[model samples]
Target: MKTAALKTVDRRDGKLAMAHFYVAFIALALGGLAGLLQTLVRSGKFELPAGIGYYQILTVHGVVLGLVLTTFFIMGFQLAAVSKTSGTLTNRQRLIGWIGFWLMTAGTLMAAAMILLNKASVLYTFYAPLQAHALFYIGLTLVIVGSWLDGAAIIMAYARWRKANPGKPSPLLTFMSLVNTILWIVATIGVASTVLIQLLPWSLGLVDRVDVLVSRTLFWYFGHPLVYFWLLPAYMAWYVVIPKVIGGKIFSDSLARMSFILFLLFSIPVGFHHQLTEPGIDPAWKFLQVILTFLVIIPSLMTAFSLFATFESYGRSKGATGLFGWVKVLPWEDARFTVPFIGMLSFIPAGAGGIINASHQLNQVVHNTIWITGHFHLTLATAVILTFFGITYWLVPHLTGRTLTKALNKLAIIQAVFWAVGMTFMSGAMHAAGLLGAPRRSSYSEYGGAAQAAEWIPYQVAQAIGGSILFLGIILMLYIFINLAFFAPKGEEEFPVGETSEKAEKTPMVFENWKLWLGITVLLILFAYTIPFIDMIENAPIGSKGYKLW
Candidate 1:
């Protein structure tokens, strides 16, 4: 708000963005490998060696992709988005932020390496008594601590900007940074506590059997919140970037703020729905969580409503009118449509399955099946991968000062569609097969019994093909990132600013209020989290159950 000399903050973001590009691909590649191996194992095509090798691979894949890769990539996006949106800074505080990025990378690498080595068998959930090497716990903790430092840096820079120019309302993009950091701190508390206190000693063999529910409870506290952590940035990208790309305005500034606040509130508390398959949790509590889960969906639905509204407005301006006719007029080549298209497509399936599993009754049909896996990957993969695709492309020109080759950028977009469709078909089939009694977390699927595995043949082939598409997408993403990250020319010439560029004053704001948004955020989180908390803490029943690997 104070300066017109808007330039790209090519801090750790450009490097981290590129560095994280590698990390994202690695995580996806390994996870894909594991998924393929798992399919082979499930189909009786492959077998595991003696010992816990399958679990080790599964665990590493989970921790690497689920925790480390997503966190790093999301942080990179946040840094870039804030810098672009807030019209602030001159690299005074950015230097400090990049220092934090290296710390995060070191911690994540250390943890991932240990997991690959079979030192941590608890999954990223890091349950106790599943002793990992101490280094794993230390590495994990450092990653989280590093994030906190990064958060402080962003906040400090924003604070400085505010102090310099009073009464200037924070842009929605900057507002996202504020809420996201708050949610991050709130969510990570559970995992941070476990890593430092419960897990550190347990991994050292100081304890025999840790309370699995306690472990699960804390994990879910983080888990549900983690979902928001992933979704918010994507949603923000969708809100702030997508419409502008399509030549439209946000449906309502108030509606967008409402969605954010609701997400923070409900996302953290309703994690227990994940625990529905476990026996120790009581039915009453699970049901209550089911109710809270429903409540959470309402806000998400509002988000969907607002998103469609934004699109419709954009569509009409392009001279389209019909129930869904506006969809056709969109600039498909633009990062806005391409990114949101992938994201929206993924959410539909995920949300449908989510509603089913949110209930105690419906979860029974899908419980512990590949259906569960398919559903989550559909949700998370779309939300994180597609949006990251857009952010990278959007930032590349700014950071490198080189406009990406049109051909290469076009290839990236096509690759995204391939990944999205491939993941969808593959994951969708997994859900159907799961309903027919396929189990999860196994390296091999054939039990050597006489039962025919013919029905799964088509599904497996589809999944493999889909995996191939995703693999190609990742490869292309890496290639593009590498080119931009290192070799892309840094042009000295000035180019016209793109829409959604706040510093350029291209998009005008409709509302400006700090307390109003902050208060709404608090209220949403409270409503979302507390209702389910009551059901879980006080009402849920208990049972003793355990499963052992063969």
Candidate 2:
């Protein structure tokens, strides 16, 4: 068995990771406030002070939380994971990571400033026709480029480990981190292409118009994988860390690796599912991508099964008997476990909602409706965000050389409960209201007091109440984060990485074949996208002039 020479992240590397957390939490604070305001406005009970526009705050909410927060936290967590598993980064690697961090940070600031100044209110998707300032696109480009540099650090470390270990699969955490990094690098190419080749020049006035359909195509190409990019790290926690937290072994190393490989292969090529409702794409191509979307579900189910097996095995060994008795043995009192467990439970319905959205017939029902917003809230906001919170309960303290006091742990649990309750009220109402035909991304309006519009009022109020509760949850989370980072009692906290169950067979070496995986991922992308893209460009319209409605 292998053992770590150090129980905590290297002090220098911890500083780097801490830098990211600082920015991420700052974003949470700013973005959380924006979200609350949005809900209140949509409830028909609030208005912005001064000249603040609704879409401007909406842009802030989406960009800061959706893009900035997720990217920073994921990059930070992956860096720490790679360091913990593969050993501290070499000096060169560390330098590269720092450069990436600063670059991304700078980009975030530039983008944020533009949003706040109302120079860019294009929203997170930044879809063309509703164009923003050139700096907005440039800032986004820097963020993507900086992330590539950040990924380079992880890649270099993985290479070093392979060179040293020769013939052994990389450490599970390290390997997962590398896989996610590669997935990110590959997927971002679509967004990067649109930003560099299309959006930036159009925003700069070098082009009189932008191709709306083509821009959206590239965006969704990057957008769908972006979901998995956020998700894979959470899966990393579920697959590797959770078992250790609950005093159990991994169900199968091979299963875990295979699932990740499946994600890499299937996630990017399937972005067309998001574009299914849009015109200009052949129904046949959309159907093909829909098939690919369903294939992505296999890994999701595999992950679910592996987790159940881990929990059951742990419960069984602890003297539990009946089929569901394993549930009783989990560490419910441990905030680290309970918090993310809530997130895992949320995914049940969240996943179901996603399946509904991907269906061609069902897409028409919810597309551009508040129902889609509700689905997004459940998936990313509740499921992914809660898992991240659960991770913070240990991660912050571990990196900071502090211990999570029982009091703080209890508070963390409370925070998670608040989140669950709030989202139930909020997202549930959204889904219901959407079914009644409420539109998304609209400011407060009675729509000439139309009956259907009036029908949405009560649900919008429920959303406001839910948003208020969630903001409280955010405040609690921020308090806990502060205590963990600074005020918590000084001590060591374990960075848990689970051991694979002995009963599982050896992992195949082919899982480590980057050539096979990347080649397949590229081929799938080509197969799914090549023809449609060619058709889009060939039949493209005269494009659109930029508009700044906000």
TM-score winner among the candidates? 2
Candidate No. with top lDDT: 2
Off by over 4 Å in 2: 1-3, 542-550
Task: In model 2, state the lDDT of residue 517.
Answer: 90
| lDDT of each residue in 1-550, candidate 2, tens digit only | 1336756788888888889899999999999999999999999888889999999999999999999999999999999998898888889999999999999998999999999999999988988889888888888988998889889999998999898888999999888999999999988999999998888888888887777888898898899999999999999999999999999999999999999999999999888788877899999999999889988889999999999999999999999989899999999999989999999999999999999899878988988899989999999999899999999999999999999999999999999999999999999999999898899888656476678788899999999999999999999999999999999999999898899999999988999999999999889999999999889877776435434211
Give the true-structure RMSD of model 2.
Answer: 2.5
- Candidate 1 per-residue lDDT over residues 66-122, each given as its tens digit: 877677777766766666656544465566666666777788788877877777766
Candidate 1: how many backbone clashes? 9
